[model samples]
Target: MELQFFLPMIPPTCTHQEKQVSVVTGKPVFYDPPQIKAARSKLTAMLAKHRPERPIKGKGVRLIVKWLFPKGRHQDGEYRITKPDTDNLQKLLKDCMTEVGFWKDDAQVCSEISEKFWAAIPGIWIRVEEI
Candidate 1:
């Protein structure tokens, strides 16, 4: 079976490359940034409402994520085609997917394809399938 969905919101600026933290009791504390946390919450809520009856389970799965960003200086219909970096953006989304139980584990998603673009309409589009 294949799973597909769209997260229709202005994609947050959060990237997994962002570090979360502070310190207490001689130990380093970690947490999501306020913005990142909010974004995760939004993604989680959306996923929970639509997630499969059971998580996708298998030895190999494929994941594709296409992120559409609000047009910058780019002309209409043109891709963002630059940095913020697609890899960085995928990290946060993948982690959120794991947290929302889209699958047994993100690691189970053996193949991944990610991308970003500039568009008049902005949101995230995701697809998953067993391989």
Candidate 2:
């Protein structure tokens, strides 16, 4: 199975690694910051519309994601080489995808390719397939 689509919106830069930790009862407790929660909500809502009729199951699945940010000082199609590393970005995105029933679990994603770019048209391009 293969799924490909583009979500037209400003890609959020918040990452899963942004989780905040606090010492509660002398133990570490982790929580998402407001921005992280907001980012997850936004991505979940956007991804919900694209969920497959049935969630993809089993192993050997591949996920490809392209995050296109607005071209401010950068030229169109230029690679974004700044903060919000791709692994961090994909971690949040895969979590959202798992929540929205895109697959049984993000662990099913055996292969992943993620990129960020400056583009005149800002959005997210995603492709999920069996490999």
Most accurate candidate by TM-score: 2
Top-scoring candidate (lDDT): 2
lDDT of each: 0.80, 0.92
Worst 10 residues of 1 by lDDT: 75-84
Residue-level lDDT tens digits of model 1 in 1-131: 68888878888777777777788988998877778778778888776766777888766789998888888678656766667788888777878888877888888888999877777788888898888
Worst 10 residues of 2 by lDDT: 53-62
Cα-based TM-score, every candidate: 0.89, 0.96
Off by over 4 Å in 2: none
Model 2 scores a C-alpha lDDT of 0.92
lDDT of 1 at 118: 78
lDDT of 2 by residue, 1-131 (tens): 89999999999888888899999999999999999999999999999999999888765789999999999999999999998899999999999999999889889999889999999999999999977
List ranges where model 1 is wrong by over 4 Å: none
